[model samples]
Target chain A: MRVSELVQRSGASLATIKYYLREGLLMPGEATSATQASYGEEHLRRLALIRALTDVVGLSVQKAAEVIQLIEGPGDDLFLTLGAAIGALPPYVESSNEQAQDYPLARTALERLGQVYDPDYPAVGQLDRALTAASAAGFPVDDDRLELYGAHVRAIAEYDIDHVPEGPAQGAIEYAVLGTALYEPVIAALRRLSHQDLAMRRFVPDSATDPAGS
Target chain B: MRVSELVQRSGASLATIKYYLREGLLMPGEATSATQASYGEEHLRRLALIRALTDVVGLSVQKAAEVIQLIEGPGDDLFLTLGAAIGALPPYVESSNEQAQDYPLARTALERLGQVYDPDYPAVGQLDRALTAASAAGFPVDDDRLELYGAHVRAIAEYDIDHVPEGPAQGAIEYAVLGTALYEPVIAALRRLSHQDLAMRRFVPDSATDPAGS
Candidate 1:
């Protein structure tokens, strides 16, 4: 595919694609002739991931480039690539302070889940940021609720791990990363709807009486 | 309590508290004297919610104000208030086209979950955005995976709905909204950590054999 096809297919503006190329966030396509280059499926995949990182995951270009770098270089090394991905988590999800107060709740939460309480862990840092922020907002997550939620998510995560694409490392990595990035909104939406469904059941009695609703 | 006390208690700065007041997000404090007005517990709670909205949930100040509007005015009406909060969801979390093409996966996913497939539903819109983005990135969510995730999230949602604080409608609204906003990061972190734990179990040989890890 040509650069134009890349632009059209990826739904990204030409200038945006050009910007990614200039920034080295994207690998350049094969040069066919003067001012013309051909992109392959790999380029398209790369472009899609880039757009998701910036547009969906909301990582800065610098951070997205780092992630792209790690993804391209590290094949089948999930932890090593994801370690860099964790670096992008807090800033990508929310603009939190790096030097924020220590997250005692996050550490304890991890430890209780039978995992080592590693502060350097990305999710741990993210958990700390979230717990600290929630506490700041005067809506602290209690230990019991955290434990229950932990158990529930552990089930979900096991399913996710079980289903990660096998064979190709790149495919598996893409699935894990994209699934992590994209499915979050899906999970959040499903969770919200589940809440809404229950709320309707509990509060909206009329829904139960309605023949179609049940 | 005085403004200083509100700041001390709420962890928001004076300028921020003033901004919320100026924006009418917080109810005005009683006029204690010429030089000072006294705030109360309600103000502290209101401020806490506001900070969570802007800082943690990453809503714009305008969106945050609108949420505070919905929360304060529409007590006991979870659907009505959250309907407005739904208005804030896409822009708050991920920037996606509200006018983007139709979302079949989202609708089907909802219908499969025994919920009304209302396009107007906020989570539907969010789910649509996520699915569409995923598909465009060449990782379209299949029906089986969507249903599997739907089933998984249903369990978590029930627990969350069950845990909605009893008593004041305002308090209930606060919990639902804050829990929706705050616990997302927690859930994401937990899901990620669970995947890590599993990945360690399957791939890391030393962890199983190591006495401390088990």
Candidate 2:
């Protein structure tokens, strides 16, 4: 298909498609004429992935490009590629968690959850940042609660990794990285919906109640 | 403090702070003289709130302003305010979920989770978007898995709202809004870390395994 059709179908403006092409995030198509080129299903998929990273996952274009490179270039160690892909995510709340500092609550939460204290992982820093922020906001997640949350999330993560298609390295890499970016809002939205249910049950007295559902 | 001090304290550029003042997102400081003014702690809090909304929540400046307005002006109904605040988050993967989406899987997931299938809530749209995207990506979240994930997230949400810092309406409003934005990264990070743990166990043969952790 032509660029115009790609833009129309993808719901992205022509300029956005052009900008992505220029940024090399979207690969160039077959040169059909002097200024015309053709795209395929792969282009559509790439566009969707790019949008998911930049718009949904909230990674900047540069970071998204790095993630794409990691996807396109899965090293000998797939585990290392996975780590790098996640590390490319936006560093939320640039605090001292980046440095090797004492985050006792984070440590407690991790130990209770049965997760190893691997300080080298970017996620440890993120966990530290989150725990610190929540604590600072007067809502310290106790060890038990943090452990419980971890169990549920670990199950979800397991389900996600289990579903990675048994195919080429590139396909699996795309699945892991894109799934990380895309499924987050799903998890978050469900969580928010759950919050709504709780609030509705507690505050909105007139609302219908379903204890069996919970 | 003065403008320079405000900039230094908040870590926002002078131009960015001035822009916020121009946009009326931040209230004007007390004018002490012709070309100078003084800010206070309230300004600092508001600045933090704005940064969370724009930087973390990925809300555009205009949308961030709207969220700020919602927080600033919580009507008599706290429930409604909560809805509006969550509604203000970025709509991930805009597809046909916005309308009365007849997503059978979504309906099943919601019903199994015992959540009310309200078409009006923005979160319903978000849930629909996430589920649909996941399914399209060939990782369909079946009803059983969705219900389990929902249960875990429900507990987290309950913990969050329970810790709403019982105080002024504005304070509570800020807590809810900021909590939504700030804590999402934390949740995502934790989930990712869990994924890392799972991947380490499954893929990396030499990696240490901790079954008791899960």
Candidate 3:
């Protein structure tokens, strides 16, 4: 297949494909002639992954490049690769002077979580950043709420892991990273759906009985 | 207090405060003089909310403005106000010509979810977008998985709504909106933390038993 077919198949624009090639986000196609190059299945897969990361996951070009490197890099360590992919996600809150005061509270919350999970894990840092953002916004999450949320998520995580097909470590790594990135919005949407349902049931009993009731 | 005091108290930059004021995301303070205006605690609170929506929830200026309108606009209806706030969140995936083929799959998935919650809700659109992205990325989520994820989130939602402070409808609306936006990252972080812990326990038995073992 040529670049044109690659573009058609991957649903990425010709310019985007070229940009990815220049950015080394996509591997160069085979040199078939002076003016023509041939893309293969690998290129198609890579292009799709790139589109998914940028278009859906909202990773920056640099972060998506890093993720591609982790996916294609010479490492069989599934856990490490998964960690890199998770790290590539945009932070919930950027570091700022305003957030400085909330770090202690964030750290304390993480310490409570540490009892169940390894506090040194990179995800712990992500958690801390989130907590700091919440506290900075004057909605400080208390220790009890954090624990309750953690326990609930642990159940979901167990189900997620259990569903991973037992196979090569590489397959597991791909599943972990892709599932984490792609299904995040799915999880969040479910949370919102649940929130809406619960809210209606508890607060708007009339509306719950007749959703059309304004 | 003046604008300077609002900035200092809210920890938002003076320029950002001015911009929000100009954008109508923040209400103008009292007209102290031709060139000076006095702000109050409400200004400070609104600034913090704007920062949290933009910085943490990642809403665009336009979306954040809509949220502010919903918050400040005349609305005694808590459910309606909360719905507007959730509706203001960035879409899980933007509509694209490339994604046209995935809509059926996304809709089917949402239909399955409708069995548990209102399928016509705005969050349902978000879930559809997410599902479309996942399917387009060649990782379509299954109905069983959606159900499993939804069950867990419903449990979490029960706790969340149960904990809502007893107060006036306006106060509950504020708590619902702010909590929804600010604590989203907290929920996501908890999910990641659980993923990391569960993965380590299931994959690296040695590390699971010996915490120091890498």
Query: What are the fnat scores of the candidates, in the order listed?
Result: 0.51, 0.43, 0.54
Candidate 3 regions with alpha-carbon error over 4 angstroms: A74-79, A92-103, A114-120, A200-214, B74-80, B92-103, B113-120, B203-214
The model with the greater DockQ, 2 or 3, is: 3
Consecutive 10-residue window with the lowest summed lDDT within model 2 chain B: B205-214
Model 1 misplaced stretches (Cα beyond 4 Å): A75-77, A91-101, A205-214, B1-11, B39-45, B75-77, B91-101, B205-214
Per-candidate TM-scores read 0.85, 0.79, 0.84
Candidate 2 reference-contact recovery:
0.43
Taking all chains together, the TM-score of candidate 1 against the true structure is: 0.85
**Clash pairs detected, candidate 2:** A114-B213
| lDDT for each residue of candidate 3 in A6-68, tens digit (9 for 90 to 100) | 888887899989999899999999999998999998887787777778766777888989887
Which window of 10 residues has the lowest lDDT sum in candidate 2 chain A? A205-214
Model 1 residue B132 CA deviation (Å) reads: 1.6
Candidate 2, superposed: residue stretches over 4 Å from native: A1-22, A27-40, A92-114, A128-145, A162-171, A209-214, B1-5, B27-40, B92-108, B167-171, B205-214
Ten-residue region with minimum lDDT total, candidate 3 chain A: A92-101
TM-score of chain B of each: 0.81, 0.85, 0.79
lDDT of 3 at B49: 72
* Interface Cα RMSD in Å, per prediction: 3.0, 4.1, 3.1
Q: After superposition, how far is residue A63 of candidate 3 from its true place, in Å?
A: 1.7
lDDT score, candidate 2, position A75: 82
**Model 3 TM-score relative to the real fold:** 0.84
How many clashes in candidate 1?
A: 0
Identify the candidate with maximal TM-score: 1
**Positional deviation of residue B86's Cα in model 3 after best superposition, in angstroms:** 2.8
